[model samples]
Target chain A: MSQVNWRTINVDALDPDSALNFDMSTLTPAVTPVSASEVQGLAGQIRQLLRGGDHEGALRGALESVPYGADEKGKEIHLHTVIEILQSIRQSEMSPLLSRIYQSEGGSELLDVLMKYLYKGMSHTTPTGGAKQMAPQATGFSQIHPLRTGDGGGQAMSVFLSWHEKLVEIAGPGSIVRVMCDRRTV
Target chain B: MAQPEIHHLFHRPIADHSFSSDRQTLAVARDNLIEIYGKSGQKFALQDELRGHDKTVTGVDIAPNSGRIVTCSQDRNAYVWEPSSSGWKPTLVLLRINRAATCVRWCPSESKFAVGSGARVIAVCYFEEENDWWVSKHLKKPIRSTITSVAWHPNSVLLAAGSTDGHARVFSSFIKGVDERPAPSVWGERLPFNTVCGEYLNSTAGWVHGCEFSPSGDALAFVSHDSSITVVYPTGPDMEPKAVLSVATQLLPFMGLIWTSENEIIAAGYDCAAYRLRGDEQGWQLAGSVESAGRPGMDSHREESALNMFKQMDLKGKVQDDTKLKTVHQNTITTIRSYAGSPERVRQFSTSGVDGRVVIWSV
Candidate 1:
């Protein structure tokens, strides 16, 4: 007889008025809505830190003030800044920097937030609204961020995947489970 | 410390097991049937098999005072087996849920039992005297996913349920006729059926696998898929809990946990070894592995001949024996129950794992 994975079975497919159809919005904790200007201001500071080769500061700045309550445009701006910092760090410095971050207070939680952003960065495709809303272009910042394009996105994916690998290596799979189950969306 | 008693029952996984008050009879959920074993000497002999459910049995609990065995299965059915001269008579319970039952636990009073189901409902069943059949009342509200485990409070009125939705909720399963009025407590003043007393979510929101009320029934502790166990102490009704201490472990997520006392908890899961966690509402931390590093029954004084050492180095390229794990259990431990002593202070506990072995360890 073929073995069945009972726990993963979708019982709701059989019952129409199933209790599983819960309102997901209520499950997540409500957050104070962040304005677009706040997200843009943070992004500007993180970019300046990145330009000065303070990758650690840039990473911390990007992760600490997550735009969990930000609007779509604000979140997109923050995501671009986060992905840029994630890619700018040298491969050799990755482990050392992660160790420092992990040892800090609330280190594990910070890593969890990073893991969530990594997941979002990987699946994030081109947004529905076009680049018409693009803020005043920063001079040195890349015109086309890899994750926002229909093509040449594999580079961005590999970067996020590698960071994910290093993260799980240090923080263990608990971080992944935390990011996956946490309802405090970012 | 005494060596843990290891019993290799069978190759099949034992999802749940329960021992009688006398510790003479043991019932284990083996595949689709419930196997009852009678202890004769040190080993248990197969005495009987209660075969009814067509699906895998998820849980089984024997009421301490009554010696009645309650079993729930993934087939969406529950049966109460009563001891009789003819044999064990099985009475089917009307759960009235569309999904499979995940867990069941007999209340301390043994008057009623709660069955948690994938239907996202807990069916608190009690015997209706007029009909002479077991019937249930559904607690349906706020639960968002499959119920993973259910535990009865010492008062038998408050029920704690852990679910895949990352919430461990406490509810009042107070059946009007079957239960007497419970005294006012921190949970609430007037208890009514389906009253949600407490709902807790860990910081990580991992799927809660096991939950239990503290020995005094004043606090709740739950193990979640994030490899953390959180202990919640309620301050009062409609008030913030005094404290919720979450101790995160680097090990694999715990599948089951049992509080040995007010301050100590023994938890085991995919890590294959039970770990002791020590703390209280003030603070909590993972103490260490319950079992020592040395694997039991190994011949520590085995003489290693010169030729044997060379052979070992040649064949495996290393003389050290690294094949077996330091822990006794070789696979994930699915269930851990207090084997001896009261729930207030357990002296010994028994754990059954997917490795097909049940080991009783002293605390």
Candidate 2:
């Protein structure tokens, strides 16, 4: 009934300012449905969980999120937040993030869960396999290099690329694709 | 607590949506078609479809005073629809460009509209009475990449465009004939059509997702892909700005935002819920979200007993399901606009997203 002032007060958050290295533990992650405040707040912890070989736990950390509502739309937002995390992995922190997940045991299953959610997230409203068709159709996405197990040859991305291959298998060979925001690289 | 009214339009992604001045009609860009919905008693019913664009329709907007709808699509075309006695008539605007048109909006005066495009230009379109058709002039000097979003000042002459080049710029779109030469504000006096008033960028050089001019047109706020929102207060056109404040948030990046007042802004995007940010030139801070999370209908709903938990596990193979977001929108919120309000204060706002749901929230 009452209005709360939601303006976040983080001084010097702009460019060419003194960086604020605030503590992450200073704010706790809410177990209840996540609002905007809890999204990137757990990036470090989720990465740590992935490195610890807790694939399911890391997957839970991502997909195990709860929305603020019981409605179907609320459910979609929850899954959307999960997709945001996956996109961050694919776009920004691919090597470090994916290597941790791929090196861990049952890491392929985590990829499968991601593939499933990718389908669910895009297919929530439409019958299209969403990510199923996109993954294979989008040629711009990075290709899965020949994977090596021992000594982890070449870039740490070898592990990452292997998981992407496994994702293609789960979502069907032709379904792996990428959707980008409004930008023109070509 | 208040319940947000949600209209589930269809299955495919809703790139953008708009409402007529009377709030009796709605138009949404589904794929290549603009589906218009007419309000019955309480729900919106399908009325007609505008089929023209060959590719996906990206944005749709209706002028409040003129009652005309402007639509832009990935097919690199923009159309203006005028309501006629029989139905809506579509007139093609000459947006001489190559890339996709990303976003479009009518100026407050209803005399013109601007379309942001992937061709790294903002096409300012208006009617050329001599030619009896709409004509556009390109704003093409400083932009390096695609223009993601564009907003108009209350005066309807100054335009704010956010681009993939990681800059939000204020340009004076003063057309010699279409606009009136009025009092000069902090932006500048003797403003030319392409005068670059001010330019600001985010901390990490993130793509500027949304840009908006405050009610008084004295301040500008923009959200970037780095999960940060920055507000700029320009003292003059050439002088050093009075203040450029940025709020780095822990949330996901925001897609679009709107000014409810000079001091309050409602922004929603990948987070799916609309958040309230209130502040002034002195300072700014996020108040919270407009919607409550995870707790609505807590007591009235069926109790989650041990039996319910087991039943969920048996059916879905999971105890805690992440299929639903606690927010009203299911996916990324593509646009947020003031539903009912004057330039100074907004009473309600609406949001449409990838989940294909349009939600109106009262403030």
Provide the overall lDDT of each model, using Cα atoms, as 2-decimal numbers: 0.86, 0.73
DockQ of candidate 2, scored on C-alphas against the true complex (2 decimals):
0.02
After superposition, which runs of candidate 2 have C-alpha atoms over 4 Å from their true positions?
A1-186, B293-295, B298-307
Residue B74, candidate 2: C-alpha displacement in angstroms: 1.1
Best by TM-score: 1
Estimate, for each residue in A1-186, the C-alpha lDDT of model 2 and write its tens digit. 247554664544652212243332212112244444444455456667766865446655764343332243444444554544444343344445544554565443344345445544433322122222323224222233343445323333333344455555443331222112211101
Error of 1 at B288 (Å): 2.2
TM-score of each: 0.85, 0.67
Q: Single out the weakest 10-residue window by summed lDDT for candidate 2 chain B.
A: B293-302
Instruction: Give one digit per residue, the lDDT tens place, for model 1 in B1-363.
Output: 788888888999998999999989989999899999999999988999999999999999999999999999999999999999999999999999989999999999999999999988999999999999999999988788899999999999999999987899999999887899998888998889989999998876778999999999899999998888999999989999999888766678899999999999999998899999999889988888888645455555245788988888999998867766657787899999999998888999999989888888998
Give the per-residue lDDT digits (tens) of candidate 2, residues B137-171: 99987776789999998888999999876789999
**List-wise, what DockQ does each model earn?**
0.32, 0.02
Report clash pairs, candidate 1: none
